[model samples]
Target: MRVGIYLDDQGRSLDVVVEAARDGAKAGFASAWLTQFAGWDALTALAVVGRDAPGIELGTAVVPTYPRHPLVLASQALTVQAAVGNRLTLGIGVSHRVIVEEQFGYSFDRPVDHLREYLSVLGPLLRGESVSHRGATLTAVGAVDAPGTKPPSLLIGALGPAMLRTAGELADGTVTTWTGPATLADHIVPTITRAARAAGRPDPRVVALTFVCVTSDADARRGWVAQRFAMVGQLPSYRAVFDREGVDGPGDTVILGDEASVERQIRRLASAGVTELVALPIGSAQEQATTTDLLVGLNTRAG
Candidate 1:
């Protein structure tokens, strides 16, 4: 399985973010992905990454699909893809209710329907084709200028059944967080792959992001992890996935332990059909570097 690193979003400057991506790439990591949130836009961050580190794959853990139109995303993704010489992966999502509806002043009803129509317009617009559709939620009637490179791979953050099927039917792949192998094997993987085959499409790639901190101080590590779980447990979307995985909370899905245990768990995820693993190191640079160095070494040695 391909191993990548997820850059931290908290209080990071553009230069710092670029440097982090470059460091990960030089450390033999396959890719460096940036998570989108209120603080930074994914495309802008990746443009910096493209300029700073050539030849390394750059991606958005996800850009929310509610506020921005897909045409805007297609244009920005193409620009970044060209800047990176086609090494960009545009991962988009219909984000949860709290952010979209309560925060952004957008209605949260029928997100699945909205996403279906959104991608319908996005696919053609990204492919440099004109799009004109009158759906229940979205309607678009033009195409953006294509960048020099073809559109980057379109990945969606899907955890639910309808969204997973939509991802298979339309987008190139699905990216996930806080989900486990059993959930993937029994629910997500089969649902998506079957839908893709039914549509005469290639099997969709599955990339999962999870907390990966390597430290002997289990208490400190658990404290770091608990903070994340507290927030995630409150989210209705993630809680449903946690329930499906039969886990108590998001902390259960995190990959935290000694190096050997972490390695074994990641391999189990790969065996369960995860194509790429984007490991999020949840501590300072020194701590992150320690885990990252070991993981990169292990992956290279395995190769």
Candidate 2:
């Protein structure tokens, strides 16, 4: 399976982010992805990174879909693709109700419907086709013109069955988090693969994102994950996945241990049908470095 690195762009300068991406590329990672949080703009920062870091793929772990119109997002994604030499993978999703409703002030009703409609408009625009869509949740009446650029591979952040079906039918694949290997093997991989086959599309990519820390102090590292990402386990979507995986909390999903143990868990993910593994290295600087080096070595072996 392909191995990638997820970079947290929170509280960091663009130059620092670019250097990180370059380092990932130099270390032989297949890709580098950034998330769309309250901090840096992921696509814009990736465009800057692409100027300095060549060869490696650049992607957004996700950009929230509710905030931007399909037209606007397509334009930005295509622009980034052009800037990145067609190395952009656009990962998008309908974020949680708390963020969409409480913060963005948009009603979070029938999110699956929203995702379906959003992709209907987004897919065509990314391919440089004019769209005149008028659906219940979204509408588009224009096209994005980005010459000399191919459509970046589109992935949806989908966990539930309906969302996975939609992602299989519409997008190239799904990007998932907080899900374990057993769940991916029994539920996620089969459901999405069946949907894609039924839709006459090729097998969809299953990109699994998880926190990893190579440490002898496994208990402390797990506790750090539990404390730092406590809110994630409480989120409804992730909670459902946790229940599906039969895990108690976000810390359980993390791959934390010595190098051998951590490598074994990652191999389990690969055996479970994950097309790619995106590692969010966690813990102290030394621990993070150890995790990255292990992942790089694994990636090299895979290649």
Candidate 3:
């Protein structure tokens, strides 16, 4: 399985973020992903990073779909692809109700339907095809013109069965967070793979995102994670995933241990049919460095 790092660009400057991605490439990571937060735009920052960090895949662990129209997103993604030599993976999703409805002032009703319609419009546009879709929740009436750029690989942040089915049928794959190996093996992998096969598409990529910390004191690191990321377990989608995994909170899903133990858990994820693992290394600076080094070593061996 391929290994990647999730570069957190919450409060850092664009130069700092680009340097981080450059460092990730120098350290031999296969890819570097950025999440869309209240800070820097993930795709824009990646475009800049790609100019300096050649040969490394750049991705958005996800950009929320409600805020941007399909045409606009396609234009932006293809522009980034052109800027980055076609090394962009556009990961998108219908974010939680609280954020979409409360913050963005968009309806969160029938989100799976929204996702399906969104992809229906996005896929053809990314391929430079004209689209005239008029679905229940979304509509598109034009095509993007990004010369010399192919469609970047598309992934949706899908957790439930319906969303997984839609992702399989329409998108390239799914990007999941707060999900564990057992859930991937039993529920996620099979559901999406079957849907993709039934839709006559190739096997889908399963990219699992999780927190990691290489530490001798596992308990202490887990406590740090719980305190730092307590809000994650409260989000409705993540809460459902945690319940499905039979875990109590986000901390329970983190890969926290010494190097050997961490390697074993990551191997379990690979065994569970994960095509790629995007790790968000957490904890102290030393612990994060240790975790990243372990991932770099694993990536080298995989290469």
* Highest lDDT model number: 3
> Per-residue CA lDDT of candidate 3, range 1-303, in tens?
999988988889999999989999999999999999998999999999999999999888799999999999999999999999999999998989999999999999889889889999999999999999988898789999999999999999999999999999999999998898989999999999999999999999999999999988889877877888899888988888889899988889999888999999999999999999999888889998989999999989988
Lowest lDDT 10-mer window, candidate 1?
A: 217-226
TM, every model: 0.95, 0.98, 0.98
> Candidate 1's residue-wise lDDT over 102-208, tens digit each?
89999989999999999999988888999988888987888888657787888999989999999999988899999988998888888889888888999998989
- Residue 28 Cα positional deviation in candidate 2, in Å, after optimal superposition: 0.8
Q: Please give me the total number of clashing residue pairs in predicted model 3.
A: 0
Model 1 segments more than 4 A misplaced: 283-287, 301-303
Q: Clashing residue pairs in candidate 3, if any? A: none
RMSD of each: 1.5, 1.0, 0.9
lDDT, candidate 3, at 74: 98
In candidate 3 the C-alpha lDDT for residue 226 amounts to 80
The residue-level lDDT of candidate 2 at 288 comes to: 90
TM-score, prediction 3: 0.98
Ranking under TM-score, best-scoring first?
Answer: 3, 2, 1
